[model samples]
Target: MSIDAIIMGIAFICIHLFANDLLPSGRIQRLKWFSFSGGLAVSYVFVYVLPTLHKEQITVKKYSDYLTMESELYFVGLIGLLIFYGIQKVVRKAQKEGENKKARTLFWMQILFFGLYNALVSYTVISHEVLGIQAVFYGLAVGMHFTAVAHDLWREYEDIYNRVGRYVLAAGILMGWIFGVNVSLPPVTETIIFAFISGAMILNVLKYELPPDEEAHFPTFAIGVISYTSITMSLKFFFQW
Candidate 1:
Protein backbone atom coordinates (compact mmCIF):
# COMPACT_ATOMS: atom_id res chain seq x y z
CA MET A 1 0.00 0.00 0.00
CA SER A 2 1.03 3.63 -0.32
CA ILE A 3 2.78 5.33 2.62
CA ASP A 4 -0.26 7.52 3.15
CA ALA A 5 -2.58 4.52 3.31
CA ILE A 6 -0.30 2.76 5.74
CA ILE A 7 -0.19 5.79 8.03
CA MET A 8 -3.93 6.24 7.95
CA GLY A 9 -4.58 2.57 8.62
CA ILE A 10 -2.28 2.48 11.62
CA ALA A 11 -3.72 5.70 12.99
CA PHE A 12 -7.28 4.39 12.71
CA ILE A 13 -6.46 1.13 14.44
CA CYS A 14 -4.54 2.79 17.25
CA ILE A 15 -7.17 5.41 17.91
CA HIS A 16 -9.85 2.76 17.99
CA LEU A 17 -7.90 0.53 20.34
CA PHE A 18 -7.14 3.27 22.85
CA ALA A 19 -10.62 4.67 22.70
CA ASN A 20 -12.11 1.23 23.26
CA ASP A 21 -10.14 0.81 26.45
CA LEU A 22 -11.82 3.90 27.82
CA LEU A 23 -15.30 2.56 27.17
CA PRO A 24 -17.45 1.63 30.16
CA SER A 25 -17.58 -2.07 30.83
CA GLY A 26 -20.06 -3.87 28.52
CA ARG A 27 -21.16 -0.65 26.86
CA ILE A 28 -20.62 0.53 23.30
CA GLN A 29 -19.47 4.11 23.06
CA ARG A 30 -18.68 6.30 20.10
CA LEU A 31 -15.23 7.66 19.51
CA LYS A 32 -13.93 10.03 22.17
CA TRP A 33 -12.32 13.37 21.44
CA PHE A 34 -8.88 11.76 21.41
CA SER A 35 -9.98 9.28 18.78
CA PHE A 36 -11.49 11.97 16.62
CA SER A 37 -8.49 14.15 17.10
CA GLY A 38 -6.25 11.29 16.08
CA GLY A 39 -8.46 10.39 13.13
CA LEU A 40 -8.48 13.93 11.82
CA ALA A 41 -4.82 14.22 12.52
CA VAL A 42 -4.17 11.19 10.33
CA SER A 43 -6.89 10.99 7.65
CA TYR A 44 -7.24 14.67 6.90
CA VAL A 45 -3.91 14.72 5.14
CA PHE A 46 -4.87 12.13 2.55
CA VAL A 47 -8.35 13.62 2.30
CA TYR A 48 -6.84 16.96 1.40
CA VAL A 49 -3.81 16.00 -0.68
CA LEU A 50 -4.72 12.82 -2.56
CA PRO A 51 -7.63 14.35 -4.47
CA THR A 52 -5.45 17.14 -5.81
CA LEU A 53 -2.67 14.84 -7.01
CA HIS A 54 -3.79 13.46 -10.44
CA LYS A 55 -6.06 16.43 -11.24
CA GLU A 56 -3.20 18.92 -11.31
CA GLN A 57 -4.89 20.70 -8.45
CA ILE A 58 -2.16 20.31 -5.81
CA THR A 59 -0.39 23.27 -4.22
CA VAL A 60 2.84 23.56 -2.20
CA LYS A 61 0.91 24.84 0.77
CA LYS A 62 -1.38 21.82 0.66
CA TYR A 63 1.59 19.47 0.47
CA SER A 64 3.23 21.20 3.45
CA ASP A 65 0.11 20.92 5.59
CA TYR A 66 -0.31 17.29 4.63
CA LEU A 67 3.22 16.50 5.68
CA THR A 68 2.82 18.25 9.03
CA MET A 69 -0.46 16.51 9.77
CA GLU A 70 0.92 13.14 8.75
CA SER A 71 3.94 13.48 11.02
CA GLU A 72 1.92 14.30 14.15
CA LEU A 73 -0.62 11.59 13.40
CA TYR A 74 2.03 8.95 13.01
CA PHE A 75 3.98 9.95 16.11
CA VAL A 76 1.12 10.27 18.61
CA GLY A 77 -0.84 7.48 17.00
CA LEU A 78 2.12 5.13 17.26
CA ILE A 79 2.49 5.73 20.99
CA GLY A 80 -1.21 5.30 21.64
CA LEU A 81 -1.26 2.16 19.51
CA LEU A 82 1.63 0.59 21.34
CA ILE A 83 0.09 1.19 24.74
CA PHE A 84 -3.29 -0.05 23.53
CA TYR A 85 -2.00 -3.28 22.05
CA GLY A 86 0.27 -3.97 24.96
CA ILE A 87 -2.54 -3.76 27.50
CA GLN A 88 -5.15 -5.42 25.31
CA LYS A 89 -3.10 -8.44 24.36
CA VAL A 90 -2.09 -9.22 27.89
CA VAL A 91 -5.57 -8.81 29.29
CA ARG A 92 -7.21 -10.83 26.53
CA LYS A 93 -4.78 -13.65 26.91
CA ALA A 94 -5.44 -13.81 30.60
CA GLN A 95 -9.15 -13.85 30.02
CA LYS A 96 -9.11 -16.53 27.31
CA GLU A 97 -6.78 -18.90 29.06
CA GLY A 98 -8.91 -18.82 32.25
CA GLU A 99 -6.15 -17.48 34.42
CA ASN A 100 -4.12 -20.38 35.76
CA LYS A 101 -2.11 -20.02 38.96
CA LYS A 102 1.02 -18.64 37.33
CA ALA A 103 -1.06 -16.49 35.03
CA ARG A 104 -2.77 -14.97 38.03
CA THR A 105 0.58 -14.16 39.57
CA LEU A 106 1.79 -12.53 36.41
CA PHE A 107 -1.52 -10.75 35.97
CA TRP A 108 -1.33 -9.00 39.32
CA MET A 109 2.32 -8.28 38.77
CA GLN A 110 1.36 -6.48 35.60
CA ILE A 111 -1.28 -4.52 37.50
CA LEU A 112 1.28 -3.37 40.01
CA PHE A 113 3.45 -2.22 37.17
CA PHE A 114 0.49 -0.46 35.64
CA GLY A 115 -0.10 1.55 38.80
CA LEU A 116 3.53 2.57 38.97
CA TYR A 117 3.46 3.44 35.30
CA ASN A 118 0.47 5.72 35.82
CA ALA A 119 2.05 7.57 38.72
CA LEU A 120 5.25 7.93 36.74
CA VAL A 121 3.49 9.37 33.70
CA SER A 122 1.48 11.69 35.91
CA TYR A 123 4.67 12.99 37.47
CA THR A 124 6.42 13.39 34.16
CA VAL A 125 3.56 15.33 32.58
CA ILE A 126 3.11 17.56 35.60
CA SER A 127 6.81 18.30 35.97
CA HIS A 128 7.68 18.60 32.31
CA GLU A 129 7.49 22.36 32.51
CA VAL A 130 9.38 22.73 35.77
CA LEU A 131 11.83 19.83 36.04
CA GLY A 132 13.87 20.68 32.95
CA ILE A 133 16.90 18.39 33.35
CA GLN A 134 15.20 16.47 36.16
CA ALA A 135 12.59 14.92 33.89
CA VAL A 136 15.07 12.19 33.13
CA PHE A 137 14.71 11.10 36.74
CA TYR A 138 11.06 10.36 36.21
CA GLY A 139 11.97 8.31 33.15
CA LEU A 140 14.58 6.46 35.16
CA ALA A 141 12.06 5.61 37.85
CA VAL A 142 9.73 4.11 35.29
CA GLY A 143 12.59 2.34 33.59
CA MET A 144 13.80 0.71 36.77
CA HIS A 145 10.51 -0.99 37.56
CA PHE A 146 10.14 -2.04 33.93
CA THR A 147 13.66 -3.41 33.93
CA ALA A 148 13.30 -5.48 37.07
CA VAL A 149 10.13 -7.04 35.78
CA ALA A 150 11.36 -7.59 32.24
CA HIS A 151 14.65 -9.15 33.23
CA ASP A 152 12.83 -11.62 35.45
CA LEU A 153 10.29 -12.60 32.81
CA TRP A 154 12.03 -12.17 29.45
CA ARG A 155 12.59 -15.92 29.18
CA GLU A 156 8.86 -16.58 29.19
CA TYR A 157 7.59 -13.85 26.86
CA GLU A 158 10.02 -13.95 24.00
CA ASP A 159 8.00 -11.66 21.79
CA ILE A 160 8.46 -8.59 24.01
CA TYR A 161 11.78 -9.80 25.39
CA ASN A 162 13.83 -7.30 23.48
CA ARG A 163 11.67 -4.35 24.48
CA VAL A 164 11.71 -5.46 28.10
CA GLY A 165 15.46 -5.99 28.00
CA ARG A 166 16.02 -2.48 26.72
CA TYR A 167 13.86 -1.04 29.49
CA VAL A 168 15.87 -2.95 32.06
CA LEU A 169 19.10 -1.53 30.77
CA ALA A 170 17.75 2.00 30.78
CA ALA A 171 16.35 1.42 34.26
CA GLY A 172 19.77 0.44 35.53
CA ILE A 173 21.33 3.58 34.17
CA LEU A 174 18.60 5.73 35.67
CA MET A 175 18.81 4.05 39.05
CA GLY A 176 22.54 4.61 39.11
CA TRP A 177 22.09 8.30 38.53
CA ILE A 178 19.27 8.64 41.01
CA PHE A 179 20.94 6.84 43.90
CA GLY A 180 24.52 7.53 43.07
CA VAL A 181 26.48 9.04 45.94
CA ASN A 182 27.29 12.32 44.26
CA VAL A 183 23.88 13.20 42.87
CA SER A 184 21.40 14.17 45.54
CA LEU A 185 17.80 12.98 45.25
CA PRO A 186 15.24 15.32 43.72
CA PRO A 187 12.10 16.59 45.45
CA VAL A 188 9.87 13.95 43.89
CA THR A 189 12.06 11.23 45.34
CA GLU A 190 10.16 10.86 48.60
CA THR A 191 6.79 10.65 46.90
CA ILE A 192 8.03 8.17 44.31
CA ILE A 193 9.53 6.05 47.05
CA PHE A 194 6.19 5.96 48.83
CA ALA A 195 4.41 5.13 45.60
CA PHE A 196 6.82 2.31 44.86
CA ILE A 197 6.41 0.92 48.36
CA SER A 198 2.66 1.19 48.04
CA GLY A 199 2.74 -0.59 44.71
CA ALA A 200 4.81 -3.35 46.23
CA MET A 201 2.44 -3.74 49.12
CA ILE A 202 -0.55 -3.76 46.84
CA LEU A 203 1.12 -6.37 44.69
CA ASN A 204 1.36 -8.74 47.63
CA VAL A 205 -2.34 -9.26 47.27
CA LEU A 206 -1.41 -11.66 44.53
CA LYS A 207 0.10 -13.98 47.11
CA TYR A 208 -3.06 -14.43 49.11
CA GLU A 209 -5.40 -17.32 48.36
CA LEU A 210 -8.32 -16.23 46.21
CA PRO A 211 -10.47 -17.52 43.36
CA PRO A 212 -9.90 -16.16 39.86
CA ASP A 213 -13.28 -14.47 39.66
CA GLU A 214 -12.88 -12.92 43.04
CA GLU A 215 -9.59 -11.29 42.12
CA ALA A 216 -10.72 -9.95 38.79
CA HIS A 217 -13.02 -7.13 39.87
CA PHE A 218 -10.48 -5.02 41.73
CA PRO A 219 -7.94 -4.97 38.93
CA THR A 220 -10.58 -4.44 36.27
CA PHE A 221 -11.63 -1.20 37.94
CA ALA A 222 -8.05 -0.15 38.58
CA ILE A 223 -7.09 -0.59 34.95
CA GLY A 224 -10.31 1.01 33.76
CA VAL A 225 -9.64 4.11 35.83
CA ILE A 226 -6.07 4.28 34.61
CA SER A 227 -7.19 3.95 31.01
CA TYR A 228 -9.80 6.67 31.40
CA THR A 229 -7.52 9.22 33.07
CA SER A 230 -4.62 8.64 30.72
CA ILE A 231 -6.77 8.98 27.61
CA THR A 232 -8.54 12.01 29.03
CA MET A 233 -5.31 13.85 29.70
CA SER A 234 -3.87 12.85 26.35
CA LEU A 235 -6.99 14.21 24.68
CA LYS A 236 -6.65 17.53 26.45
CA PHE A 237 -2.99 17.79 25.60
CA PHE A 238 -3.33 16.84 21.96
CA PHE A 239 -6.68 18.36 21.04
CA GLN A 240 -8.41 20.51 23.64
CA TRP A 241 -5.62 23.11 23.80
Candidate 2:
Protein backbone atom coordinates (compact mmCIF):
# COMPACT_ATOMS: atom_id res chain seq x y z
CA MET A 1 0.00 0.00 0.00
CA SER A 2 1.15 3.48 -0.73
CA ILE A 3 1.69 5.21 2.63
CA ASP A 4 0.08 8.38 1.35
CA ALA A 5 -3.00 6.49 0.21
CA ILE A 6 -3.23 4.67 3.51
CA ILE A 7 -3.01 7.94 5.39
CA MET A 8 -5.71 9.38 3.14
CA GLY A 9 -7.93 6.42 3.98
CA ILE A 10 -7.25 6.95 7.66
CA ALA A 11 -8.21 10.59 7.29
CA PHE A 12 -11.58 9.57 5.85
CA ILE A 13 -12.11 7.09 8.66
CA CYS A 14 -11.34 9.68 11.33
CA ILE A 15 -13.84 12.15 9.88
CA HIS A 16 -16.58 9.57 10.03
CA LEU A 17 -15.67 8.42 13.52
CA PHE A 18 -15.18 11.79 15.17
CA ALA A 19 -17.25 14.11 13.03
CA ASN A 20 -19.40 15.53 15.80
CA ASP A 21 -16.43 16.68 17.83
CA LEU A 22 -14.85 18.10 14.73
CA LEU A 23 -17.98 20.17 14.09
CA PRO A 24 -19.23 23.15 16.03
CA SER A 25 -21.61 22.67 18.95
CA GLY A 26 -23.87 25.71 18.61
CA ARG A 27 -26.82 25.41 16.26
CA ILE A 28 -25.95 28.41 14.11
CA GLN A 29 -22.27 27.57 14.14
CA ARG A 30 -22.96 24.02 13.12
CA LEU A 31 -25.19 25.22 10.30
CA LYS A 32 -22.52 27.58 9.07
CA TRP A 33 -19.85 24.91 9.26
CA PHE A 34 -21.94 22.51 7.23
CA SER A 35 -22.68 25.28 4.79
CA PHE A 36 -19.02 25.96 4.29
CA SER A 37 -18.28 22.28 3.83
CA GLY A 38 -21.12 21.99 1.36
CA GLY A 39 -19.66 24.83 -0.64
CA LEU A 40 -16.19 23.34 -0.63
CA ALA A 41 -17.55 19.97 -1.67
CA VAL A 42 -19.53 21.48 -4.54
CA SER A 43 -16.56 23.49 -5.71
CA TYR A 44 -14.38 20.39 -5.73
CA VAL A 45 -17.01 18.58 -7.76
CA PHE A 46 -17.12 21.24 -10.46
CA VAL A 47 -13.40 22.00 -10.49
CA TYR A 48 -11.94 18.52 -10.08
CA VAL A 49 -14.50 15.75 -10.29
CA LEU A 50 -16.05 16.88 -13.57
CA PRO A 51 -12.77 17.17 -15.39
CA THR A 52 -11.67 13.81 -14.02
CA LEU A 53 -15.06 12.39 -14.98
CA HIS A 54 -14.47 13.43 -18.55
CA LYS A 55 -11.36 11.30 -18.54
CA GLU A 56 -13.27 8.39 -16.98
CA GLN A 57 -15.94 8.74 -19.65
CA ILE A 58 -13.31 8.69 -22.33
CA THR A 59 -11.84 5.53 -20.86
CA VAL A 60 -15.29 3.99 -20.76
CA LYS A 61 -15.87 4.90 -24.39
CA LYS A 62 -12.51 3.58 -25.44
CA TYR A 63 -12.82 0.23 -23.72
CA SER A 64 -16.39 -0.81 -24.31
CA ASP A 65 -17.76 -1.35 -27.79
CA TYR A 66 -21.07 -2.83 -26.67
CA LEU A 67 -21.84 -0.33 -23.91
CA THR A 68 -20.96 2.72 -25.93
CA MET A 69 -23.60 5.21 -24.93
CA GLU A 70 -22.06 8.61 -24.29
CA SER A 71 -24.05 9.02 -21.10
CA GLU A 72 -23.84 5.55 -19.62
CA LEU A 73 -21.59 6.78 -16.85
CA TYR A 74 -23.92 9.69 -16.23
CA PHE A 75 -26.83 7.33 -16.00
CA VAL A 76 -24.99 5.44 -13.28
CA GLY A 77 -24.46 8.73 -11.51
CA LEU A 78 -28.15 9.48 -11.73
CA ILE A 79 -28.90 6.05 -10.33
CA GLY A 80 -26.62 6.70 -7.37
CA LEU A 81 -28.42 9.95 -6.59
CA LEU A 82 -31.80 8.33 -6.96
CA ILE A 83 -30.81 5.48 -4.66
CA PHE A 84 -29.86 7.86 -1.84
CA TYR A 85 -33.00 9.94 -2.34
CA GLY A 86 -35.12 6.82 -2.24
CA ILE A 87 -33.54 5.75 1.04
CA GLN A 88 -34.14 9.20 2.50
CA LYS A 89 -37.78 9.11 1.43
CA VAL A 90 -38.39 5.69 2.90
CA VAL A 91 -36.79 6.58 6.22
CA ARG A 92 -38.67 9.87 6.48
CA LYS A 93 -42.01 8.38 5.52
CA ALA A 94 -41.67 5.62 8.04
CA GLN A 95 -40.72 8.05 10.79
CA LYS A 96 -43.51 10.51 9.91
CA GLU A 97 -46.20 7.86 10.23
CA GLY A 98 -44.83 6.93 13.65
CA GLU A 99 -43.87 3.46 12.58
CA ASN A 100 -40.94 3.03 14.92
CA LYS A 101 -40.34 -0.58 13.94
CA LYS A 102 -40.26 0.15 10.23
CA ALA A 103 -38.09 3.16 10.74
CA ARG A 104 -35.62 1.22 12.81
CA THR A 105 -35.36 -1.44 10.14
CA LEU A 106 -34.90 1.17 7.47
CA PHE A 107 -32.26 2.87 9.57
CA TRP A 108 -30.04 -0.16 9.25
CA MET A 109 -30.83 -0.24 5.57
CA GLN A 110 -29.74 3.37 5.20
CA ILE A 111 -26.50 2.80 7.06
CA LEU A 112 -25.65 -0.22 4.95
CA PHE A 113 -26.16 1.58 1.68
CA PHE A 114 -24.37 4.67 2.91
CA GLY A 115 -21.47 2.54 3.99
CA LEU A 116 -21.30 1.04 0.52
CA TYR A 117 -21.44 4.52 -0.95
CA ASN A 118 -18.58 5.59 1.29
CA ALA A 119 -16.59 2.55 0.27
CA LEU A 120 -17.04 3.21 -3.42
CA VAL A 121 -15.96 6.81 -3.04
CA SER A 122 -13.07 5.79 -0.82
CA TYR A 123 -11.89 3.24 -3.33
CA THR A 124 -11.25 6.01 -5.83
CA VAL A 125 -8.74 7.62 -3.50
CA ILE A 126 -6.32 4.84 -4.25
CA SER A 127 -7.58 3.77 -7.65
CA HIS A 128 -6.65 7.15 -9.00
CA GLU A 129 -2.94 7.84 -9.37
CA VAL A 130 -2.89 10.53 -6.69
CA LEU A 131 0.39 11.27 -4.96
CA GLY A 132 2.16 13.81 -2.75
CA ILE A 133 0.41 17.20 -2.61
CA GLN A 134 -2.34 16.02 -4.93
CA ALA A 135 -3.29 13.39 -2.38
CA VAL A 136 -3.38 15.98 0.42
CA PHE A 137 -5.65 18.26 -1.61
CA TYR A 138 -7.95 15.34 -2.38
CA GLY A 139 -8.10 14.32 1.28
CA LEU A 140 -9.00 17.82 2.41
CA ALA A 141 -11.66 18.28 -0.25
CA VAL A 142 -13.33 14.90 0.14
CA GLY A 143 -12.81 14.87 3.89
CA MET A 144 -15.06 17.93 4.04
CA HIS A 145 -17.50 16.19 1.74
CA PHE A 146 -17.66 13.19 4.03
CA THR A 147 -18.19 15.48 7.02
CA ALA A 148 -21.40 16.80 5.50
CA VAL A 149 -22.56 13.32 4.63
CA ALA A 150 -21.80 11.93 8.08
CA HIS A 151 -23.63 14.83 9.69
CA ASP A 152 -26.73 14.01 7.66
CA LEU A 153 -26.67 10.44 8.86
CA TRP A 154 -26.04 11.62 12.40
CA ARG A 155 -29.06 13.85 12.23
CA GLU A 156 -31.21 11.13 10.76
CA TYR A 157 -30.25 8.39 13.22
CA GLU A 158 -28.23 9.88 16.00
CA ASP A 159 -28.53 7.10 18.53
CA ILE A 160 -27.74 4.27 16.18
CA TYR A 161 -25.10 6.33 14.40
CA ASN A 162 -23.30 6.97 17.64
CA ARG A 163 -23.53 3.35 18.67
CA VAL A 164 -22.70 1.51 15.47
CA GLY A 165 -23.28 3.37 12.21
CA ARG A 166 -20.17 5.51 12.46
CA TYR A 167 -17.93 2.53 12.97
CA VAL A 168 -19.47 0.76 9.99
CA LEU A 169 -18.83 3.70 7.74
CA ALA A 170 -15.31 4.00 9.06
CA ALA A 171 -14.79 0.34 8.35
CA GLY A 172 -16.02 0.90 4.82
CA ILE A 173 -13.21 3.34 4.20
CA LEU A 174 -10.65 0.90 5.50
CA MET A 175 -12.08 -1.90 3.42
CA GLY A 176 -12.01 0.20 0.31
CA TRP A 177 -8.36 1.02 0.87
CA ILE A 178 -7.50 -2.61 1.52
CA PHE A 179 -9.31 -3.69 -1.62
CA GLY A 180 -7.60 -1.04 -3.69
CA VAL A 181 -4.31 -2.24 -2.33
CA ASN A 182 -5.00 -5.83 -3.28
CA VAL A 183 -6.96 -5.65 -6.51
CA SER A 184 -6.56 -3.38 -9.45
CA LEU A 185 -9.85 -3.05 -11.24
CA PRO A 186 -9.91 -2.35 -14.95
CA PRO A 187 -9.95 1.31 -15.94
CA VAL A 188 -13.47 1.05 -17.37
CA THR A 189 -14.89 -0.42 -14.17
CA GLU A 190 -13.02 2.13 -12.09
CA THR A 191 -14.39 4.96 -14.19
CA ILE A 192 -17.93 3.72 -13.73
CA ILE A 193 -17.42 3.66 -9.97
CA PHE A 194 -16.02 7.19 -10.06
CA ALA A 195 -19.04 8.38 -12.02
CA PHE A 196 -21.46 6.93 -9.50
CA ILE A 197 -19.49 8.49 -6.63
CA SER A 198 -19.52 11.89 -8.29
CA GLY A 199 -23.28 11.84 -8.65
CA ALA A 200 -23.88 10.64 -5.10
CA MET A 201 -21.46 13.20 -3.70
CA ILE A 202 -23.19 16.02 -5.53
CA LEU A 203 -26.54 14.99 -4.09
CA ASN A 204 -25.19 14.61 -0.56
CA VAL A 205 -23.50 18.03 -0.51
CA LEU A 206 -26.49 19.84 -2.00
CA LYS A 207 -28.90 18.19 0.40
CA TYR A 208 -27.24 19.90 3.36
CA GLU A 209 -26.69 23.22 1.61
CA LEU A 210 -30.36 23.53 0.60
CA PRO A 211 -31.76 22.99 4.07
CA PRO A 212 -34.54 25.15 5.56
CA ASP A 213 -33.97 28.86 4.95
CA GLU A 214 -33.45 29.42 8.64
CA GLU A 215 -30.56 26.98 8.61
CA ALA A 216 -28.81 28.08 5.46
CA HIS A 217 -25.87 30.50 5.75
CA PHE A 218 -25.28 31.82 2.30
CA PRO A 219 -22.34 34.09 3.10
CA THR A 220 -20.18 31.42 4.70
CA PHE A 221 -21.09 28.99 1.96
CA ALA A 222 -20.19 31.55 -0.68
CA ILE A 223 -16.81 32.11 0.97
CA GLY A 224 -16.22 28.40 0.98
CA VAL A 225 -17.03 28.03 -2.69
CA ILE A 226 -15.00 30.99 -3.85
CA SER A 227 -11.97 30.31 -1.66
CA TYR A 228 -11.79 26.61 -2.43
CA THR A 229 -12.28 27.17 -6.15
CA SER A 230 -9.57 29.80 -6.22
CA ILE A 231 -7.16 27.55 -4.35
CA THR A 232 -7.93 24.67 -6.67
CA MET A 233 -7.34 26.83 -9.73
CA SER A 234 -4.07 28.10 -8.31
CA LEU A 235 -2.91 24.57 -7.56
CA LYS A 236 -3.72 23.53 -11.08
CA PHE A 237 -1.76 26.48 -12.39
CA PHE A 238 1.30 26.15 -10.18
CA PHE A 239 1.66 22.40 -9.69
CA GLN A 240 -0.55 21.12 -12.51
CA TRP A 241 -2.14 18.79 -9.97
Which candidate leads the pack in lDDT?
Answer: 2
Q: Give TM-scores for every candidate, taking all chains together and pairing residue i with residue i.
A: 0.25, 0.94
Would you list the clashing residue pairs of candidate 2? none
Where model 2 places Cα greater than 4 Å from the true spot, the runs are: 209-211
Q: How much is 49 displaced in model 2, in angstroms?
A: 1.7
- Decoy 1 TM-score against native: 0.25
Look at candidate 2 and tell me the lDDT of residue 78: 90
Q: Write the per-residue lDDT of candidate 2 for residues 63-152, one digit (tens) a residue.
A: 878876678888888988888888988998999999999998999999998889888877888888588888887888889888877887
**Per-residue C-alpha lDDT of model 1 across residues 1-241, encoded as one tens digit per residue:** 2333223223322322232233334422221322222222222122221222222222222534444332332333345335534653675587578776655556545544543443343332332232322233223223222322332343344434343433433343333323332344453343333333333322322221111342234343344335544543464467542
Relative to the true structure, how large is the alpha-carbon lDDT of every model?
Answer: 0.35, 0.84
